[model samples]
Target chain A: MANEVAADANEHGSGGGMPDPMHQFEIKRQVELDVFGIDASFTNSSLFMVIAAILISSFLIFSMRGRALVPGRMQSLAELSYEFIASMVRDNVGAAGQRYFPFIFTLFMFVLFCNMLGMVPYTFTVTSHIIVTFALASFIFLAVTVIAFARHGAGFLQYFVPKGVPALLLPLLVVIELISYLTRPISLSVRLFANMMAGHTMLKVFGSFVVGLGVLGGWAPLAFMVAFTGLEILVAFLQAYVFAILTCIYLHDALHMH
Target chain B: MPQLEIADFAPQLIWLAITFGSLYLVMARIALPRIGMVIEERRDRIASDLDQAEQLKQKTEEAIATYEQALAESRAKAHAIAQETREKISTELEAERMKLDRKLLDQTEAAEARIDAAKDDALSQIKDVAATTTEAIVTSLIGGKLTKRDVSAAVTKALSE
Candidate 1:
């Protein structure tokens, strides 16, 4: 998506020859490879995902090496993240969700790290891509559906039919409920991807303004960029929280069906 | 937009699967459980510490109770000993007093006997004196002296009257 915009900017001869704001989102192949003829080339996006994985693993694993009775700063951070997700599962999904803590925790850390890493200059925002978010969302949707079927069997379909509705309107309500239910993945994925992409794009646009405007006039946009960066950081954390919490909510719906 | 590039999706998904799957394994197998164990261990340690504290407190209370019991027992014994000693002294004093009273009574009776003997001796002397004086007077008046026996008998009759 950003590659197309960068090309357009290049063809148009960008105003003041400023770098394309969309160029940062371009997917450049770092190590081209063929995995069973599948073009599984290693790209900047893959690099960041690997970095996110490594950072998350190392942060959680190494920080907890001490296992102190009284936690230190890093250890406290690790514990706080753990408890944060743990409580999210407990509060949103109940005790039944305890078994799924690791998965939820992983999803949160992955998305959180990706979003945060993207905030750094010259880093690719993996979650900015719709496909990535869609993958995660669809996986959650599939897992939740599987869990619903496993737990409630055919009774899971009853979730579409609301109780206390007029019998005459039941068919219409069921169809609406089914549509909404089917759109869960789309909504979930787009919500995260849109937020990440939009925030980053806004930051890039303002950054270009800062560059295009000379030093005297650039301060205004520069200041806005600073404040907006803070907000983007907040949005980054919030989106990850939303992603994980929604997963919990969906799991709750799947498990409890109400 | 590179995001819409279907060509990039495969690699991204493949890497995502590799990285995310491996991360999940690390978390589930190594990282998460270690954290959980630490937390669990801390909880257990705290619970055991509380149990130990409670036990120590109970022991302290028991020790205090025992000390108090011993103190009360000794206090009662001390009271009993003092009471016994006081009663023994009182009885001893009473016996000593009774002995002194008997000795005083004996001394008074002996002194009275001595006084009576002294009075009797003086009275005998007075009779003899009276007999001697009467003989002298008769001799002087009638040119003759009465016998001692007679004088004694006359003195005795006068003393009796």
Candidate 2:
């Protein structure tokens, strides 16, 4: 996509040879795949997802091959990630959320790896897509709702009905609560997607500026790009953290119903 | 934008499900439990080590107490034995001293009796000598041929007066 945009701009002599900053997000088919006629073509996005998964698995499985009581560097990383999510669940959702730790852990590692991988030159970011993040958020929303209903039966609906409100204002408040409750997945998904997309797009744009400006003038945008790249990496980790912690909070609400 | 392109969404979701699901399995089945086991094993090891140390400490205390008790008992026994031996020796010494006193008293009495007898014999010998001398003088002064018996009788009478 970046190549197409660069080609078009050069032909028209309009963009002054600046590649499309949005082009990095374009998906490319790696292997043509069809399942039940569903266009499940394996694209660069899927490939990165697979890479993220494999990397996460290998990092976890192989680093712990020693299972040393005193951990080495890789093992410490694995355990640190494990304990990080463990304590997150323990603190946010209490012990009842322990069973959901693997899911939360996978989610955090997946998003973090994808974001970090996207920072590398010419790698597709899986979390930068809306569908992916939305799918995850919706799944969590549905699961949390199911869990709440399963645990509390009909009392789960009482979550939206605030206590101690006058009957006249109760209906209005209930509608507002229901809307907010429904928007959880949207907010969760957009927060991750927007942060990733905007950061990458901005980096690409600044990177193009560095290329457009020759050596004598390029240093300014290049320096800004360097600092922005660092910020993007931090955002990558922070967004993943935010994603997992929000899931924990949702799970907490579902389990305890407050 | 490629993200809004509807054609890529299905594949992306499919792979997301596949990879995420498998990742969860790997963690749940293999990786996480191993880490938990290592931590659990370390904790158990430390706890058992502490327990063993406590037991050993108690054993040392018990041994020290036993040793002190034995020391005290032996010390008392030695004191009692010394007291008994002192009493026995004192009684034996008193008996020996009484026997020695009796032997000295008997020897002194025998010696006194012998001295008295010797003094009496010497006095009698002295009287015989006196009588003989008196008779001899009388016979020399008075007439030659006086009878020994008469002289002896006269001497006896004078001695008597």
Candidate 3:
């Protein structure tokens, strides 16, 4: 019965079949290519990621080339991006964490550019992939954990045992802390991936509806498209913020060892 | 391609390796160093500017203090000179007053001595006239023969003392 519905839906599409909104989440080959023992499939996700990286680097370099005391339009954008990430780090991790400014700034820029790039027509959101986000999150989790141990040595274990808790409730608190600690990467990764995937899928679905409804009746979906487009843009910025903020929190945990 | 469960993990691992390795390299090499250089440069510039400002301020304060001291010294010298001139003028006035008083005292003593001598001479002449008159009246009343020798002898004896 589901197949029937899917087939019926496919019939209405311009193509022989309807493309799954979920299809965008799938990793696939963009070119027939191979490298070494590995299949170098230049997938949509990879393409968009590379584009994001290039755009980030070029934007900063070009804007700062002048390095004017009085910033021009491009320079203001560059400075704003720098200050935004810097402030996030400072607010979360305090002055000591300022040393990690470059790392945090890079993370914010890479994620932000990827998100904004994905919003363009025919672009893939690399951040929407579970693999991508999970890897980024895992790195942060591992790095922060390593830093805590390196800084605190054996005392790192004390982070799990809250200081003021009574002995009776200590075990319970430790369990809760451990569970939360283990779930950090999961929560961080899922937030980015889910929001991006859901928003883009909705957009594709609505976009398809606009085409399917034809010009005269298409105004409804078209209006939804406009509103959803704006919403997606908002989501794009939000996801980057969420990701960067989580990184800062993780860094804070590392620095404070709490 | 048939779906292999192991193949599912392959993409994830590759992406993980690429992301981790690339990010590590970027941070260790390019991004961090550049950022560090920028922040350090800004700090050094601010420090130097503060130092220069401090030096300039000290110099300015020293100049101001020296200027004030010189002005005070000049004012003090002027006051001293005026004070000395006033003292000299007052002493001169005091000396002139004393000199005039001494001259007036000498003239007053001379005038008093002359008047005392004239009074003594006048008293002697009055005694001589009284003696003569008293002899003539005594003789006229008594109706006695009083000779000029006797009268002259008495008048001379009285006048002699």
Per-residue lDDT of model 3, residues B1-161, tens digit only: 11122443355446545654565465547644544455556668789999999999999999999999999999999999999999999999999999999999999999898988888778666665766676778778997777666776677677777
- The candidate 1 chain A region of ten consecutive residues with least summed lDDT is A11-20
| Model 3 DockQ (Cα-based) | 0.08
Docking class of 3: incorrect
The lDDT-based order of candidates, best leading, equals: 1, 2, 3
Instruction: Decide which is better by TM-score, 1 or 2.
Output: 1
Note the residue pairs that clash in candidate 1. A1-B1, A1-B2, A1-B3, A2-B1, A2-B2
- Candidate number achieving the greatest lDDT relative to the actual structure: 1
| Comparison by TM-score, 1 against 3, better one | 1
lDDT per residue (tens digit) for residues A203-256 in model 2:
988877877787988999999998999999999999999999999999999999
Runs in model 3 lying further than 4 Å from the true structure: A1-12, A15-19, A26-28, A35-37, A66-80, A94-101, A149-155, A163-173, A212-224, B1-16, B79-161
Docking class of 2: medium
Candidate 1 achieves a global lDDT of 0.92
- Candidate 3's TM-score reads 0.68
Stretch of 10 with least lDDT, candidate 1 chain B = B137-146
Off by over 4 Å in 2: A1-15, B86-161
DockQ of 1: 0.75
